[model samples]
Target: MMSVRDRLEEVFERLEKRASDERVYPKVYWAAARAAADAADERRRAGVTLGPLDGALVSVKDLLDVKGEPTLAGSRIFRDRVPAGEDADVVRRLRQAGAVIIGKTNMVEFAFSGIGLNPHFGTPGNAIDPKRIPGGSSSGAGVAVAEGTSDISIGSDTGGSVRIPAAFNGVVGFKPTAHRISLKGAFPLSYSLDSLGPLGRSVADCIAADAVMAGYGALVSTPYPLSGLRVGVPRGRLFSQTEALVADAFEASLRRLSALGARVSDCDLEDLLEQMREATSRASIASVEAAAIHSDWIETRAAEIDPRVQKWIALRLATTAADYIRMMRKRDELTRAMDRRLAPFDVVALPTIPIVAPLMAPLIADEKLYNKTDTLVLRNTTPINQFDLTAISLPIPDVPLPVGLMLVARHDQDRRLFEIALSVESALPH
Candidate 1:
């Protein structure tokens, strides 16, 4: 059997070969991998113990700055942008933990769309079915991890960017508690909601990445058993739009959890939809913050951005000041309500993305289809942002395509959520 380092070298060679053929992203860098291998060898020579992620190949999303690499965020608008002087905070941490930074993966332009269609860089196809999308704006991040080209891939999730692609690619993806990890050097999507996370092949892999990013010494759990944990099932609109396959898979997941001795119960949040509506009614934090970040660029380089992204930004720019204020006020109220509601459960479960991955061709052609699918894709995941809660999307089995079962915990209960996830993941069918 090949060692992890040897396996990574093979993956790098294969990915470099594929890069020439597919043009999945704009560029690939092998220097980072070489550096990581060197460090791992040094540690071995000194007989120093290594972390679980030692020698693991990690991929960074294009939205983030890797030292000496341009932060494209998948747009031609920044084609001539200079390389970053330093690594993004998460990238620095990963390197320090003995993981190799492979290269910057592609994303939706400025991390905008759920469909992952990049007019500038060609979109990465789903690992399960190449004809369909891998989901975005963490598109290539998911592809890199799922294809075994990288052991873990870092992505920024404002809404469903991380989870959507992870679900589409049949991998484990985690969005840590908002603000849990530093965002320095990361290109902003939605400043208030953006979170740096990872996509990996297993829950342990995801946790390993999280430990590094969070600057935790180790992932020491209190060993909470699954038997008595209360898993809340939010009743109503959360599942109203789910397709039959997702519905069945989600139901089966609940049964599996129950069989593992979890106390699964229905949680009634009569105001859930109303609160979500109110929070997003006027100007969402994402829209307003995104508009703010791109205000100057939108004015000077309006024609340079992808038309769809430009239109979305324009809509945000057009919002009245009152709209922003109203949304902020309501967002606070909704956050409080969600906190109160989720207090009793260890984790609230929902589908990561209500619908499966859709083809990029049709969505790129028809704006309406794009909007509809985009909204549905981010619906479940976005609520966590609204409440400022920590959540994780675990992939479910027995589905033709990848689907995620979202586990949401109360505000600031991130560790608890991760612990619950570990237990639930152990009980999930392979």
Candidate 2:
């Protein structure tokens, strides 16, 4: 077995190598990590064990505060901003758990896009296929883990930001319900919808990381029995416009689960879908909130903002107070409608994305293509956010292309969702 010191040193060495080779991480904290690593090693030598993530290497999204480091949130807009006074709540927890805090990974500008593209700091290419996107706003967090620079990545998921990248990059991403994890020092995309999650190589790794971030000591998830487990599939909208490869693999996965004694059923989601449609009829709660957060910057520093991001934030200016109030009301109604609808089933399963990671070239060249593709990429995963639910995206094994199987639960059912996800993850091909 490798000693904690040896493991962390190895991780830091890899971080340096990865930093030189890729644009995934814009900053590196070797000095801090080295000090933390030595401390963890000392604790181990004294027979004092740390938390579950003791001495593990971890990277945070730049959207978080790391005490003394200015969070760029993947934009040049904050290049001259002052350093943070303290770590974000999640980062503080990780440090307490003895994790070697490496450095901040890059992200989409202000976490506005599902497709990870940052003109200021280069977009991190996908690990599996460099030609395709690495999904974002947690883009670099996903790639850091995929490239083995970090054992786990702590990221924020507002609207498929975490899970979309996980699917596209072929990893596991778990988004806990909003308010479950502290967001005190993290930059906000949508106050109402934002949640913290971890992207890792496996379901168990994510469980461990989540426990640390949630201040729950260690991971305590147990696998639920798969036999006779009721897995619901939303009948419509989820599968519309899905690429053929994703459709086939998702159905095949269901068949495999059924073979393993799990009962698969198509859920009657007409009413739930209607509520969701109303909830998201116009500008997202994110755009409005982001507009509030960045309006001053957009007004005076318009040239500094990403055009795509600026356009979305600017839309929030057009949102009247009446529109905001109606949106909130619809949000409440939809959350309740989906919660009641999911109460009877153990979990709901859907394709994480109806499509694979789209190529980056065309999207970069054409604004129209970027808008259409971004909508498609976020379609399946965004509903979980609208309903204030928790979800995990697990890659389908043995598939010709990377496809994620998303399992969802009602709000605050994060533990139950993890148990269910583990069982399905085990049954699915690696």
Candidate 3:
């Protein structure tokens, strides 16, 4: 194997060639990355390897800490913020596991949008189609993984930040159950909902990154037999209203799984999802919690922030405490009910997004169009977060633009979800 330093230098050269592209990174830590990799190479010579992830190049989202870099979160508001005093908890763990940190990827401003539009740093287009949105808040993370700049990209998924971009970029994105990884030193959009995850080329890559982030060696899921596995398809808007090509691709994936001996059936999760939608509609925890975190900045620096993000956060001033309390109570009840509804199946399947990546030009030009498209983009993936569950979105091949099939599992059943995804991924024809 080539030395880790060699690999990191190659990545650095490639990044420098595309120095003007903000879609991929905030800053390239060429020296630090090379130093880390050199240390790893030394350890390798001494027979002290850090398992499969040793010497790997990885990307961190801008919201994550990295000792001396400012946590921009893709907005101008933080240009003057002090540099971090130390690496975030996840960065600390990745370093210990012998991974070389390449750079910080750009994201939606404060991780509030699903469209990945960063007005301050310029919106990063989709890797598959430069004209389309690359899925939000983890936009640059997805691009870094798709273009092979990083072995894995670590990002946060408050709603669909990780999975949406993964779906758009044709990579595997895993959103572990909240609390599975530490959030210390990471900027929070909604501390109540923010959770960290990884985007990579395959399920195995995500599995390895997740393990390392949790302070361990790579985790392995036992090979599960496809035969007799029960996968549920929820019957409602999640199953309907999908674009022609997207629906066709999702159905074809289901057929392949069924042919592989898995029992695919439709179930009524409308009540569960509906309750979640209603509660969130009344008052979004993301908006209220974001307001709390930005109260000071919103008062003094609203103009410096993205206008759309600013408007959304400002609306929290109108939210009543009673409404927030009611929403939380309802969310708890619906979460329990949804878990029970999905308990009978090994996994629940859905199209990660109702439509493929949309062109950014028209959406950005029209507020109505942007809002409508953003809601559609987030509709399917947000419910999983509301229920505090885990999910993985796997890319579906044979399409012009990428499409993803999401497999959702009960809260804290991340390992089980990975196994199910592995079986499905293997069954699909590449």
Residue clash pairs of candidate 3? none
* Model 1 clashing residue pairs (backbone): none
How many clashes (backbone atoms < 3 Å, residues ≥3 apart in a chain or on different chains) does model 1 have? 0
Candidate ranking under TM-score, highest first, comes to 3, 2, 1
lDDT of 1 by residue, 275-314 (tens): 6786677766787888988887875787788887888886
Assess every candidate by TM-score. Answer: 0.95, 0.96, 0.97
**Model 3 TM:** 0.97
Give the range where candidate 3 is weakest over 10 consecutive residues by summed lDDT. Answer: 215-224
Question: For each candidate, what is the lDDT?
Answer: 0.82, 0.87, 0.88
| Index of the highest-lDDT prediction | 3
> How does residue 326 of candidate 1 score in lDDT?
80
The alpha-carbon lDDT assigned to residue 119 of candidate 2 equals 91
Q: Which stretches of candidate 1 lie over 4 Å from their true place?
A: 23-25
In candidate 2, which residue ranges exceed 4 Å CA deviation?
14-21
Clash totals, every prediction: 0, 1, 0
Q: Return the TM-score for candidate 1, rounded to 2 decimals.
A: 0.95
Off by over 4 Å in 3: none
